[model samples]
Target: MTDYVAKALEVDIDDAVRRVREISEQEAMNQAISVVGAGPAPGGAEWEAEQGTDTPAARQTAWQLVRLRIELATGIDPFGTVLGLRRMGTTWATIAAAAGVSRQAAHDRWGKQVLGVLDAYGTGELGGPVADDEADLRRGMAR
Candidate 1:
């Protein structure tokens, strides 16, 4: 679970718990992304037909797979950041600021939900290609 983000933000598991529970500004990020406006858009835009006649429906189908891939892969990012920040000692107030809501609202959206993901990660329940060191994924993010 240790990564650049975790290291730089000091969001290892212990820190996540501490940061998430308190409102202290020891080292929290000033802004946070709201779940409502923060999600990645489902994409099927660049899919090229690999077989058959490249019809609109065929194109649609090709892109459907892309959308599915994106959804399955990066769905954890928003909360992962929250979990990391929270674990790192970032305050809920900081998180809520980014979410544009009260601290409780951010907690309600991501608190318990993050726990489930944290559990999965803690037990290695989920496995796949996790980004290791590359940065700047704005190209893939929602517009």
Candidate 2:
């Protein structure tokens, strides 16, 4: 396929995936809101009748869902960005500087795993092996 066509297809797929994520996150937020909005805590008689067994689980799940929604909504995929930067030859020291951590600390914390992901993604554009133009694009984006 032509490069333009391939790029368009990739963009379409990315958009579809993003939409699915948004919908799932919205549903999760709605569920969490419902759980939190449920009326006041049960009194002795009501508590005995209703059984508190599900309350803790529900609240925990709801909160967890809410956290996930926040993460997704924030557009902060540390893993992806870190791996991408590493693949683009951003040294650990540079990354650490940007992140406000020591170089050794950055390597110790993320070097192996992030590099591994970067290797898997092949340091490229369109989520494939890195190419010269892709590197140029990354540099452009950085600027």
Candidate 3:
């Protein structure tokens, strides 16, 4: 929502949403500055995405810190789908053909995880626990 607005308007995300929604002009400006640091990323490259709001200082958000965290926290499990396909007797070559990747590349990306997941869950279902990467992210965010 906010992301789409930010990209569409070519303005800071806070300005695209929070700034326009504020009751007072000063509050909006302050909030915008606090996150965006007067100027940087389309929406405050310094913003502490983990915090979401009310960050004490700006930090480099390059390397896609916010997008990476958000994606890890919330999204479909392509790996899980791949695992299911493999369990269903789908060949790496077939999966790779659909995914537009080489067989070895697909295997290299998901083979280890798929092999461990069936045993780890002891289930052949489509979905179960979050992936290891998401689990690690949740653990980090817990602190």
**Model 1 residue 116 lDDT?**
69
Give the count of colliding residue pairs in each prediction. 9, 3, 0
Pairing residues by index, what is the TM-score of model 1? Answer: 0.29
Superposed Cα deviation of residue 47, candidate 1 (Å): 44
Deviation of model 2 at 23, angstroms: 11
lDDT values for all models:
0.43, 0.53, 0.48
How high is the lDDT of residue 131 in model 1? Answer: 21
lDDT per residue (tens digit) for residues 86-105 in model 3: 55455666556645677667
The predicted structure with the larger lDDT, 2 or 3, is: 2
- Candidate number with greatest lDDT: 2
Range of the 10 consecutive residues with the lowest summed lDDT in candidate 2:
124-133
lDDT string for model 1 (1-143, tens) is 65887676764587666665343222121211221122223353433332334454333333332332232243423554565544444455556665567766766677657546645657733233232211222222323
What would the TM-scores of all predictions be? 0.29, 0.32, 0.32
lDDT of 2 by residue, 1-143 (tens): 46997777666577788887677656655664675664346676655655647764445444543443343456534444455555544555555665566766666666557646655665533344322223433454467
What is the alpha-carbon RMSD of candidate 2 to the true structure? 17.4
Candidate scoring better on lDDT of 1 and 3: 3
